[model samples]
Target: MESNENILEVENLKINFKTYAGTVKAIRDVSFNLKKGETLAIVGESGSGKTVTTRSIMGLLANNAVVEGGTVMFHDQDVLKMTEKQLQDLRGAKIAQIFQDPMTSLDPTMRIGRQIAEPLMVHKGMSKAKAMAQALDMMKLVGITNAENRINDYPHQFSGGMRQRIVIAIALINYPEILIADEPTTALDVTIQAQILDLMRELQNKISTSIIFITHDLGVVAGMADRVAVMYAGKIVEYGTVDEIFYNPKHPYTWGLLSSMPTLETNGDELPSIPGTPPDLLDPPTGDAFAPRNSYALKIDTEKEPPFFKVSDTHYAATWLLHPDAPKVTPPVQIVARQKQFAEMQKKLAAEKLSHPVEEEEERQ
Candidate 1:
């Protein structure tokens, strides 16, 4: 059951990567929250800090990376302030992540059952026999055929989709409070992708764990997410409920992302593409990073960064176009003449009423 209670809240997160070239400002003051028993989909191009943001939650950033600021509050405690021991305790037992590729996620030498059962032993201190029994049951739960016989098989024996299923089984074995699925269906075919998505939805209903779905495809997010955050240049350019983002998008980047998606009605029409590449994060842009690509760019777009303008209680976008003084009204001739006609008619009627006050009084009587 979904609730207004937030399971996790990320505020003003800033992460920088130390590179040979220079410091890369990967995440720039990004903030969003996930509601209990809901999916929050983060959509953006590659290197837009989608993966980095989730990794921060897991305390899995690289050695060279530095977290300059912000807090990831899971329930009451701040995840950022946790020690290495605390993060280790938190990772699989409370918050688990599924990587993109299933092929690389599993170990070829290890038996599939052992890998899945290992988490239970480590986290819950369950005996080997009990953990294995639980793992077998989980395998069956994830729709594995003839699970008793197949539980001992190696990771190499399973197909792409089946391996992904195993990965999910491991992630959910601990029943983590939050699941971070980093494009889990990206490698599978359309049929398999649908199956995985359906399985996730089913699991979510059963477990009621909040999910952070990271994907570049808006199509995937439409049915999956309760809310959506459209990211660009390491920042959330727009944020809203799923319906609001799809039907009433306010940001130019969101518009471009939606337009680029292939619709059923897009029969043979050329796909619309957003012009210009993303800014170099090594030296970030002064104004709006998307100004070069935004065709509706105003002078203010290049001169200053636009803050998030509230479209509704749940929807907001970072754009100067939403400003009231951004555009001036210049009424067309036809509209102006129509307004003049109405004014002249009201004046003529008033003059006649004054000239025949007795007649007006008699009519009223």
Candidate 2:
């Protein structure tokens, strides 16, 4: 469930990396809030700064990276201002990260149980016996079977899906307040991906931790996220609720993302893809970062960057198309069709609820 209370708030966060060639502006004025116990999905292309933004929150930015401006406020404390020791204490104990590759995250030399228990011993000052006991319980909670016996097994002993579960178990062992999942399911098979997603949802309900899921897959975002933030060329181009983003998207980049997602009804020889590449960050565009790729871009988009315009109290998009004086342009045909489909589904669900009020009441009980 979602809440009104913001557990984490990022404001005007600008980040850059120093390279031999030049400075790479990775994150530019990116801001979003993660409500307590809510899942916020950050969606974008490869270099759209989805990972960078989350990494900054975890205080894992590279040494060459520069925090040009802004603040990441977690529990009223600015994360950027925290020292290395403070960051070390904050991570794992209060905030945990689950990366995409489980192989890299887990230790090959250590047994699975020891790996999971290490955090408890270091952070919570638990005895080895107590930590191992907690590790076993966590493994079971994450759906690992025969945990008492298999705890002694090495990382290589587990399958890919099992390894990922172990990684998740390790992350949740301490019941961290916030969980940063950076493309956690990208490496798994489709079936395993679904299982992992289901497990995450179940665990979230149990733990009540806020999640920031970073991924390029809009399909995954649609299912997992309570709210969506669409990033493009180091900036958040659109921010809205899941329903608003999927059914009433206002940004061209968002439309492109939605259009590219394949559906059961899709009947094309080739899937639709966004026309142009993402903007180069070494020397970002003078105007709108998405101007060159946006089909309905106005002259103003080429000349000036558009501020986020309010579509609703909760929804905002940065695009010249949202300007009142700009010519009206509808979303792509596929996107419009998807919106209609979603509307029909909602109507059907509403009708079903009205028809089966008794069942609904019983279920509530």
Candidate 3:
């Protein structure tokens, strides 16, 4: 059985970047923890800061980046406080990341076997021959056919799916305790995507390695993750078990996201979309950042930020709609079903002037 102990903990992690335009607040007080042997999926739209959050943990941020505050604890040591040499020792030896693009992740000039073996040779002080032997075993483990025959081939020689398997082989070469897979199957076809997901699940079970899976697809999250964290504009809006999020979501953003997902029942109906673009990070809004796009936004959402409201022991959402005095607004029909869980919450909700300034002005005019 997978232990309940936390393998990684990130608390109040705030990150920013310096550009000629201005400072971009990429991550805002983002916090989550990964339990040992658990798969935690971080889902959001593009440019929502998923990749940046993972990179910060790896200590792979760009030169212009600045961590305003927070601590990342791993094995009782603060990862943010680790020295350069210490970080070098931490990456690959204890943690490994599989980037989205396998072609760019692998070296074009080097042979496949050598690239996979390099980590073992560098981290464990193993001879090249021994590392290559282990690399061959890893190749077999990741489902590369005819490993001995293709080990010496260049990256360009393999198909996209095969290349991804090679990338996975390199990531698992050292048997690291934590794996960060950033959209590892985004570039492949549907069939190949399924294969990769299954391979990851199988490998995790065998090694008991914890995973931080980042992607925008909720479908993928359904099969891979134990917990799901929905992010919008750098903040985690709603997060809980896969069932809680898909069946009984609370936040408007979560409703929009789940409604937009194409399901088996979705055939001829028009897919719903969240109105308006995401907020500009350079000048972030003081109140709820998602209020502009959320039709369910309460007046308080525009005046002050809403803190996380407890939905259940394992579920929570950040929205003024969860406030006691807020009106009981119905979710979209498509995303509404499980009302028993929050039935008491609905009773406590009192009517309020739910309209924002524009709606009130329009009504007066």
Candidate 4:
């Protein structure tokens, strides 16, 4: 059993899809822990099982999806094994989810407030009038001014950002302990995406809830995550604190991700993307899933699976390069430069903090 400190614990989870084409092994031996009130961002390229891992946690996978092995332990309960009735009861109240597209998740025909109040009324047995009032408050809490008047408006009436705010309002109406946001702002324009991300961070501060954020955007991970889990081909290639993943990445896959981030230095030049497509899940290769694309891949990486070698107390990477006997190789030139840039930024921030002590404290007071 996991503790209250650890809100969610996924252990050796293996999920499969029984499609007409073939049986696809979507999530293989995936394990991670979510601490209370922490944001754990799952970052990877598309089709890397980031969505599938979270969907499994929320009990939202399709009917044809199969749990081949292991467990998703939420508050010491195996969410994967839960019956529909049990999950239905637990979902909105205990584990709320925000999808990539708010327009599709929302009921376009219904009043926004009514939709927001649904979870509160269903889970908490609140009166309709009371829930409606609470729903309006939730909208305001999420930075929506004039929420009371907008309560009767349908989802179609709101802007994309507003619609996502409404979705967030609905997710928080019942005060869930864990919020699984799967690409919550992906579809929005960059400007609106910033607003939504800011809103989410502010809401998280107010509620102090654990958040499992799933995104293909590497940029989003650094700003939002305390820790990050980098997935590739249905397996976690690297798991570590945000600083570790960004500044001192160990895995070749992680290095590739960092090297691919667009910067002013790139100046519209195409960033270094990981070469080769991800492996087909229907027939995953026997060794490291990322071996084929990894420039630093070794003979052993192609013949055997690499264990999670410890990089630090809080960091680990599944790559043969981490082995003591493996030849030491510098990260890609771009990644090294990126790390140096980050270090300088951190030093400047620290100097500023020391030079202007108590300024923020005075503002808070």
Candidate 5:
């Protein structure tokens, strides 16, 4: 549990896109809080508004988009209400965004070092010499080899993983307090994905910066997040600590997400995917957004929206199943089996630590 001094707070956040097709409600009443130095993962399938929600915070939406309602409060200031000058002052200074694609985010013509140092020079009034020096250090910190020499290289000179690392270096160069990473690993290979995630975690530890990690990968969420928010059709269906989400999920949508997570045991025989596609946001169903795909949907879930029912002090879920009159139902067996396996692994590690206290102490040291 983090302190009440939240680093970022989104309350009733709504984003709508006016198109010839009609107004698409990409985000509806989306609310969450990111505490200082904590990682809050926004997880969901494609078109679930995971990226859009964070984009609203960064004020990076397209021209057709409009924030219909809600407030984005950051460090005691409502960013949604801030003037363009104030927002510009905050961006790349107090906050930085890491796009999913390194190729798109990086400048092909600009030298990597200059690209990294440009934000510092523009926002922090840093001298070119000092900023370049700091940029080399940041590249090295992010695992670039011979960073001092490689600093002058262009984006094309670096490999895919290296380019991604360079992008991360630029995002962190300004030492922004809030880092928004939108599917940062989606473009990388599995091995590189692990490396990038590890680098992000290490950087977070060193800087004590808060992270808003948006990804469709449950595996990424498991490894990186302290808390999880499951979104469906522009709204959060479930929000809780990582443990609660993985072990005791209350929403059927969340259950589906956990069950569909790819595992080694799946043996490449076609990963188990969710049954139905996400609902159309432009003309969503009358009630719960997940009701169409939810196997355990009740009548109320289809006809009337379910309020977020408190499951515990820290966990809450929006589902009719949480209603007092709803029948007791257990989560799917696959999720239960996975949770058991995870618990056993934890137990084995705990026992190993107990039996080899000296090794554990030495490792900690």
Candidate 6:
């Protein structure tokens, strides 16, 4: 559930990368608000600007990248306007990131403990001894056993899962207010992925930090996100709560995403995939970015971009299908069925909660 207090707010963020051929419009007029202590998942295919959007927030874009316009407001401070020194101070201290590959993130020559303690030593200005102690504690917190002894081991000495845990430790060493995890579990196996997700959930509850989780996997989004922002062609096509996104998705791109997920009840051998390729960012379409690929796209979609239409108090979608004059179109059959299943499951959970309210309260305690 999202709180009333917003921790970060990004408004009309437009980003472009300079290249030999032309300027690539990576993120165009992207806007979203993240509540404190809530996990917001940015779900989209590769090259959809999910990573770039988060990178903008971290102020970690490449040298050729240009922030055409926008404001990334964190704690009332405009991050885009911050000096290089200020950004340096904020990164890994107030805002930390966990990259996709642990191997690249960890140093091959450095001891794992020292790598984890470096953030503390630099950001918190703690002594070597104290930082080492805190790093060991963080290692244990992230489920790395024998941390005291293992801390001396180099990155090559640990397994992939352990390396990721070390990366998490490094990210959390300073107890950052915002954690950006860019496809953190993509390289791991299913079992390790599940464990990592559970560990993150537990840690988030303990630290009460806001998270911006970037991923292309809808299944992962379903389990982790409190709110979801579905991006397409560098723009957010749909924004809503987890339940709203899963049960009542409004955008065609979102419907395509949900349909592409493999379900237990799926009878077909092959999963349904979205037709057509994404539009080229170098020459972005004048109207809706997704208009070319959208099967349900109206004439207006090709002529003009649609404004965000309010679905509910919190739910919004930027698509012509939401317009009053547009013909009603039902979502895919699989999604409708999934929504019903989710509704039933919610009812059962509610009944259980009602029957054992004290148990629930005690469990929370």
Best-matching candidate per lDDT = 2
Q: Which 10 consecutive residues of model 2 have the lowest summed lDDT? A: 263-272
Candidate 4: residue 316 lDDT (0-100): 97
Ranking by lDDT: 2, 6, 3, 1, 5, 4
lDDT of 4 by residue, 64-111 (tens): 998989999998689988999999998889899998899999998899
lDDT of candidate 4 vs native?
0.89
105: Cα error in model 4, Å: 1.0
How much lDDT does each candidate structure score? 0.90, 0.94, 0.91, 0.89, 0.90, 0.92
RMSD per model, one decimal: 12.2, 1.3, 11.5, 2.8, 2.6, 2.0
**Between prediction 3 and prediction 6, which has the larger TM-score?**
6
Clashing pairs in 3: none
List model 3 lDDT by residue over 1-365, tens digit each: 36789999999999999999999999999999999999999999998999999998899999999999999999799899999999999899889999999999999999999999999999999999999999999999999999999999999999999999999888888898899999999999999999999999999998889999999998899899999999989899889987789888999998988889887767897898989999999999878999999898778888899999999988999999999999999998777644453454454542223436566779899
Clashes of each: 0, 0, 0, 0, 0, 0
Residue 289 of model 3 has an lDDT of: 97
Using TM-score, give the best candidate's number.
2
User: Which runs in model 3 stand beyond 4 Å of their true positions?
Assistant: 337-365
Which stretches in model 2 have alpha-carbon errors above 4 Å?
Answer: 356-365
lDDT of 5: 0.90
lDDT of 1 by residue, 129-221 (tens): 999999999998888889999999999899999999999999999999899999999999999999999999999999998899999998899
Candidate 1 vs candidate 3: the lDDT winner is 3
lDDT of 2 by residue, 53-74 (tens): 9999999999999999999999
- Candidate 4 segments exceeding 4 Å error: 1-4, 346-365
What is the TM-score ranking, best to worst? Answer: 2, 6, 4, 5, 3, 1
TM-score of each: 0.89, 0.97, 0.91, 0.94, 0.93, 0.95
